[model samples]
Target: MKAFKTSKRVLSSLIAIMLLVMSCQSFLAADGDEKKPLNIPEITLENLQVRGGSTTYLVDNPPYSETAPTMRDFDFGPGSDNMQDAYIVYNYGNEVMIESLTLVGWWPKDQAVKNISLEYFKDGQWVTAQENIEVPWQTSGGTEEEVEITLTEPVTTMKFRVKINSAYHSWSDKICMHLMRPNGYIVTEFKPLTDAIAQAEKLVSQVLIGNKDGEFSQDAVDSLNAVTNEIKEKLDAGLVTADDIPVMIEQIETAIEEFTSSQNPMENAPAAEAENLTVSLGNTAYLTDRQISTGMTVSFTDSENPAYLTLDFSGKNLNATGLTLLASSSDKFTLNMSAEAEIDGVWTEIAAGTDFNYRCDVQGTEGHKITFDSCTASKFRIKINSSTAESFTVYEILWDGLYDTDTSAMDNLINKANSIIKNPASSDYPDLLDILKIVLSPAENQETSILANQGKIDTITQLLSEAISAFDGLAQYEKGDVNHSGSLEIEDVTLIQKHIVKLLQETDFFDEYLADVDNDGVISIKDATSIQIAISSK
Candidate 1:
């Protein structure tokens, strides 16, 4: 089957514009309060263009820099010598998770935008998030144009680019983006503020003086003096009453005392006392400082004697998902006791058909995979389905030394993660990269630039540098090859002219998938384009 040929110039122009869209606006969103500003990620500008007075957005030739700006300054036209094209690049921290993006176009009069589109990374490749929206902007009588598009899914970073469609009136083609921050809220009340200020002040004192200066000490004396001076000045200026001064200072003193006590190193930190565990539905347990070695059989059991459940850990990670029914040998299995629930006053069985009602899956059947699966709530009762009273032995896993343990598994994980991250829109990429860092950081520290157990950090460092160089090269190649063909053919120019849409959306179509060509995981669009550019140059 013949693949579609896309215009390089049009595609780059569109993608670049979208990436730049992030840098154009400086809207600071509040996650919950004005005190805590939301964090927006940076995106890359791959390409942008204006032809026949129409605009188009495209995928960037090179992968964007992780540290790229999230937005930029935009200025369209004063007419005669107007800027017909522009592009930008950016990266979001960790992951992008926003519901929608709002754009405020800065224009003098009502103007029309030809087309608008968004591109984002997903599934290890840059994929189109939404179908193209071709709403001809009839913005003729406005100072600033406002447009908002709801996204199909949450995104951490994206490229948004729009082109100016010739309008009845002349206006500047500028737009600003306002991103929603996903950090949520720190506090919903003002009480936290007073406590915060007090805590800060206390920290300052502790750092300057000794921790022993608590209660009625010199540190306290100095703190009181400072408070008295401030209160005296405010009172003299009629800013506060004497009663208000005492109340304020008292609050300040209370905060300082709390801070001093909190920061002080305790002589005897309480040791955690291990308890013979009880397994109950709704009983919460946190796994910290965990490890897995070759001969470990992980399991969980109920509080009652004679009954216990063992989990199979033969595969990689735990693969149990919501409401899992596990057993050691089919005899001592743990399952939700109640098969039904009471509605208002009457009881009813949960029904057998739907996956929601009741489900069961095996974990250790010789060739099984371990995964992080969700299970039914711990609140449910554990019914021992097996009539034989027996106690199953599940070997407890041990905690290996922190950092890289004795295995090649960490190396394999890092390699796999690197491969996945390079792909656009791969949900697991970010997490895998994160785990690699945590696991490989010791290796990273052992050598200046090499990854853990990769042997010689320089090798990995070189790979990173090479990847970046390839990305840069792709960006340059896309700019040089405006017309889509491999050799700048006449048909390529026509392709760019006639179908602006296709050119913008599919500029480096196959490269994104091909870049991670070897499927080792770490081929970002920039990596793919760079390799293509290198090949074209050769």
Candidate 2:
């Protein structure tokens, strides 16, 4: 039966060759014109025409249709029934020389095309260029097997045909011829560079000049600007090609790195402190530094008497987001811990943990972190609950959040006061030195004080200005000494009152400027009252 089938295939090929010769001769006679072969760099679907096939299977399924296949359409065929006689002819519409043909087979080892014969039409006759070419089965799942056949001598033809002699399977007659191409395929698609370039330009525009956060140095900014401009010019002039896109993108990336690396980091602000921090067991407060410092530990071995730590920012608030506890146990034990924040006089639990058997290994201390949504509160507490531990040491505790206060005003005031103290106008006034010394200390403290608000800073500034004014007044006339008696006394108070009731004229008073004791631009009962108060206090 196999010998009979082989004889039948040989006879079928002979008959097909005769028919192809007749068709070619008829096509040549119809044209009766000789023309030069087209200079096509590569064959593509647009230029190639495909026709002729046996009955197709699954032609209506997706990625397959009744429509004829093109040069690179991979899901072209699975010739049904008479697989040995199935043939496909590809026409290039014009004569072109092809050096190699690549055939991609169907997936799944059994359904792939196995053997094929290649024939080309030249000199008005069908010529067998290659015979019995074997295509390997696609054994690698989901990946197509491509077989390339390099011709012993390159062939020039307007059309070629591939005869599907056999497939690996014969039961279902399922055979597929996936793709065929002269030479290899070329992809010409690329993503547009406009969006990427625009994004880089936007970053450059947002850069600022300063040593603060999000600011860059002028040199870095300038360098980035130059690079961006050059790239933009090249893009605008259409000098950039699809092949150049990756290199251009890399250049922009390098420029961004350089710009970021050139930034001057912001100066680190001093660490903030709570207004009052205490660690206590019940009513008794621990006398430690109440902070996370080196060699500091608040340990309690008795599980019956646990301790809790509290941080009070007075009336000020912190936007608390997270906290860390650096703790270790002397033995294997479970240390349960929890935290709460005071909101509107109510203590609400924020985070909790248990089964922490953290021990001091060779790596030193280990920290457990608890993170939660940010909460605005003035007081926070960490409770070390009852645990089965011989002893546990808390080396440190750190809070992560922003202190909910803007101290820029107080900071500026301190700077101004420091300038005045460093560059004194005159050293003769010991009283002025004393007053300034009193003003400078509190002003400096407010710069980092969590309790410092704008209202308090404004009041302090007003008071300091008044003190300097009174010091200046001493050089001219004794403030509040309206009687010129060389002292502030009851007579000075009486003269201010008599002058207010028109008994003594303003011209009769000694230094009427001194009579306005409060420097409120008026000599009235208020000045008399101020003098009396000063005398009584003295």
Candidate 3:
């Protein structure tokens, strides 16, 4: 009875947190929304031209148009050896006060200069940000450079001309520029993600099996927290990323509620869903939610990139008959999506790519569906060949498929892994990690063949069984004790801080499942701040 009481108390508190959070979301959203909109007149671009640089070293990028940056190498024009010799006159129809000006060089670091200086028209006057900034500066993200410059004050002008007499670079001798911008976008469409998380958390405690301290599944918790972190990353960058937020949040919520599904596959099993597919472009994980952008989806990739992306189901032993590629935007574009299969590691295009058409603001026909011969070979690849839109954004990839191997045992293992990850004891770390590897088996770069490959589906089941036999039982853990030190201290806060700053880099510190002090699904910097405050109050 006492144990039941304790469990009830914890749950009651959590429910309260959920309710309070939901009530304040509207208020929070309102706070972020603009109250008094900034008044600014419309502006137009007129006959703009480049001047002075070495006319011999012409920068070729198409000026102020085209979604894809089409400027050829050495696009910065009228290129004289003198950097000041090159600049553009931006003639506008109306004069407006712009808060900032940023010149974008779509490349990575090391290849471009980090800093630059130029004089531009402001209030009908030509001036530079720093009179002392005489020489060229350095740069980063060499593959795609985004150089941002902020002015001391808003520049009011009708016509602005910049003169760049010189520039500097550490790697490539030539400088190629992309686009310039005013400021980053602010996304207000976040209610879907927040509402989904809140609803899922409200229901989770009701489904938890045991009364132990870390009774809930950590994997489900981590999955929720991971999305939370990814959303934070996008918001910090000031990017509008809510297009797929509703879908992603829904998928996660479904994953959380999987326990509500029937345990017997015969009764009901997980069908082929859109979430299983992986995407990338030539060697780089372009659409992968793994980086700065939400691993769930990305903005856009230049279809013109010779090395395009492939969505593959090569190692899952799953034979797919058809595919559906989703476009985030409604604008009509040539959809160059194709399905290919590999025989002896060679890819043969199975479906000829076609144009994908959609009318923005129109209903239906937002995705392109392709049918193909069913094959389970590891070489199956799907590529977005090209699009009418210079760059197109493909968010979700869905397929119709079935596993060749028996999945009864696999499903059972997945359930067990989810359970163990949610409430791991101190000694469950090694096995917990092994379980993760199994669930995420047949990962990219795994050997291609079943005979020589260690990534076989059977291997995961066998490893999972062994790990289960070694369960270390459960232990109570303080919510902020990330290091499993048995007590919450200043060091625990520091460890989480280090993880946030990229100093420690360990993502599995939350095995105890109690490290999420606020139960927001994420162990973010805010959690660290909360811990410090808790310590002070004590």
Q: Tell me how candidate 3 scores on lDDT.
A: 0.46
Q: Write the per-residue lDDT of candidate 2 for residues 182-211, one digit (tens) a residue.
A: 531112222234445554666566556766
lDDT of 1 by residue, 1-538 (tens): 1111112221223433554554343443455423322233343333332222111122112223345422222333322223243333333322234455444332313433334444554443455555444433324332333344566664543223232222222434333221211222111122333343444444354343444312233554466446545643443343543345347657666745543344333221111111232433111111111101011122234344222222222221221232222223323333222222223333333322122111122343111112222322211111223222233222121111112223333333344334334434344445544544454454445443322332334355444434333323222223213332344333333343333334434543222222233344443344434445555666
Scored against the true structure, residue 437 in model 1 reaches a CA lDDT of: 46
Clashing pairs in 2: none
Model 3 scores a TM of 0.27
Please report, in order, the local distance difference test score of every candidate based on alpha carbons: 0.33, 0.54, 0.46
TM-score (all chains, Cα) for each model: 0.20, 0.26, 0.27
- Compared with the true structure, what per-residue lDDT tens digits does model 3 show for residues 1-538? 0000111111223333432343233322245753221122122222223322322122112332234323233334323334443444443322334444444343523333233343445433576644323222233433333334555555544344445544444443454554333321222444446556555554443333343322344555556556655654553343424466666676665665453231112111112112222333111221222111111222234334422345544354557687676554435556566777666678777777765665533542255678888866644545655555543345445566755555345445554444455554523477556656554454211223333222355676676666655554556456677766667688888888776776775464543244567765556888888889988888
User: In each prediction, how many residue pairs overlap at the backbone (N, C-alpha, C within less than 3 A)?
Assistant: 74, 0, 48
* Order of quality (TM-score): 3, 2, 1
Model 2 lDDT at residue 465: 61
